[model samples]
Target: MRTIGADSPQGIPSSLNTVDIFMSHEGLLLEYEQSLTRHLPSPTDPKGERKWYNTGAHFLWIGDRTRQPDGAHVEYMRGIENPIGVKVGPTTKPEDLPELLNRIDPKKEIGKITLITRYGAGNVEKYLPAHIEAVKESGHVVVWVCDPMHGNAKVAPSGVRTRHFADIITELSKTLRIHKDNGRKLNGVHFELTGDRVTECIGGSMELSDEDLSTNYQTYCDPRLNYEQSLDVAFLIAKYYANEREDMERNVFRL
Candidate 1:
């Protein structure tokens, strides 16, 4: 695996000998999450007040389908101290963002919330800028993450659910560019990928086609990038960010 944040020309801090890999999952099942919830001593509070945290995963996110303002998911998520993520899709109203932010993060703590954008390749150009603006205007501290997988899924000719690599790349590239142009840093990315040789997603350096999918199609739900394709995406993101760093160095005023 290519190590990031250490021994690179980009000057990432060498604070640790090993890279930390965090596990994040969609907080879809409320009952399971509730079952794993634990009361832990508050890290920030000096008064010794305990905080509720879902210990099943290091990070948890509310799905787009369950993020209603006054809904149970939102209510449950607001009570937890674990860093929370909320899915923001094409249908997410820009005006509703502040209210949602206020509901989840009333204190507006930095890094307390993350907004994961999954607008498909076609809808990103139409929707993202406004969401960015809305979040900025609200003055709520939030990390922006791009999830390019879920929205680009399509059924192939063989009737197997799959996502096109080209579409995924397009969405990711566009999200990066859009965030840079809008004067915001896209803090991270989310992808459905695996370290196996499953041909769930088509079109990469291997030129896997729709017919090739049936050879090793293996996902019970949405498709994922195979080992080779996952590397392709990793390299693509690294290259884009490297170029961005160069651009920032060349023009300090580029934002």
Candidate 2:
């Protein structure tokens, strides 16, 4: 998977290897790993370079079923939260995740992994902790997606109305506080964005109305925000943390 950050590109001495792997620790489908030999942190040691040199000869995000000089999984990229026939929906067992994580450990079996999950499940508020505890887990780092902009706009359950992003943001803040109060480092946020300017949190144009918010942005993963919208959320996250009186703030707002 490609990481969105500073050291990624524009010359930071990062390995930045984009190659495919047969296994991934979490939702990272091995077949989707077309290239993992690009954009990696500068290897701390020579062995790190060996890890780079030892990458798959031809990493393919899509296996034999697809072919292309350059290809992308558009469907997977669009959003695959709760599939129709699949039993793995937002409410799927959290234990299922850890098991999958083990099955997909293609990297260094590194603990303290960071993940992006649906804010709709609000697992950060509940299930995530249970999952973390069940593994007797001390090697995971979870940053939740609490952007209302990403929430389904049309079908936001019974009472969560349009323009509910602020509320969701507050909820996320509380979740962070809860984690920290309990001595867990709930380090950051996982929000969506792009390069264009987004006018509204939900809508047809760059802007959105309450009606628009009611449908599209209401889903678990809302319309992909333009670059402008994306950065707005990033700034909003920063503001959220700035207001807190906490002692430790290690939040990194990854796009």
Candidate 3:
């Protein structure tokens, strides 16, 4: 529930209000500003346990770098009951997933685990199918969420690492298609976005270019979609899902 707008230190415009806009969509925006804390053992506790899951956050995830099966981060997350996710990058091996899934979701409970795919645009088509097949074959029910932004990142002419809007859409489309082909469903999308008018990402309906980025590129990490750009993405994703639902209904009617 952070305040949005140019009045805030983040330099986003009040009119954008991306947080409020998304909140209306029945989704929870779990905060991860201090995500590193999830890795460290509690300072005051003797057992050195991770305490972030107890703080009432709706969802928590371990980043790609910390998802190693033997790592403490995953070990800590394994015991938590909150819906959890792990970032899966291109280099992830299909053979390693059973161990990871076993560690995190030993019971294979529905909605308890999510696999967030971050394979880059070029590699997703090549690498994602194996992971999907592996997961399917294991009979583990996991929500598949696409992290298109991270995988599609490229260095813009301004030297900032940015993701192309078209590339983001392409990856999302491909992920949906892959999941459908595998007889699984793609449940969500993860994005790095702000409720500001900053010009960090290129393309979208605004036709933002490299030159526009110099105006207010304020992100410390990856480039995020600004308010308008974020809305554009949301609408596009909604359309994709709507079409999917429609197709499903049509197939049922035919049967």
Native RMSD of candidate 3 (Å): 9.1
Ranked candidates, highest TM-score first: 1, 3, 2
lDDT of 1 at 37: 96
Cα deviation of 145 in candidate 3 (Å)?
A: 0.7
Assess candidate 1 and give its TM-score to the true structure: 0.89
| Residue pairs with clashing backbones, model 3 | 5-12, 6-12
Better lDDT candidate (2, 3): 3
Best by TM-score: 1
Candidate 3 error regions (>4 Å): 1-53, 252-255
lDDT of each: 0.91, 0.40, 0.79
What tens-digit string does per-residue lDDT give for candidate 1 at 8-72?
44555555645877878888889999999999988789998898989988889989889889999
Whichever of 1 and 2 has more lDDT, that candidate is 1
| Per-candidate clash tally | 0, 40, 2
User: On a 0 to 1 TM-score scale, where does candidate 3 land against the true structure?
Assistant: 0.77
lDDT, residue 104, model 2? 30
The ten-residue window of minimal lDDT in model 3 covers 21-30
Among these predictions, the greatest lDDT belongs to 1
Predictions: Cα RMSD each = 5.6, 12.0, 9.1
Taking all chains together, each candidate's TM-score versus the true structure is 0.89, 0.47, 0.77
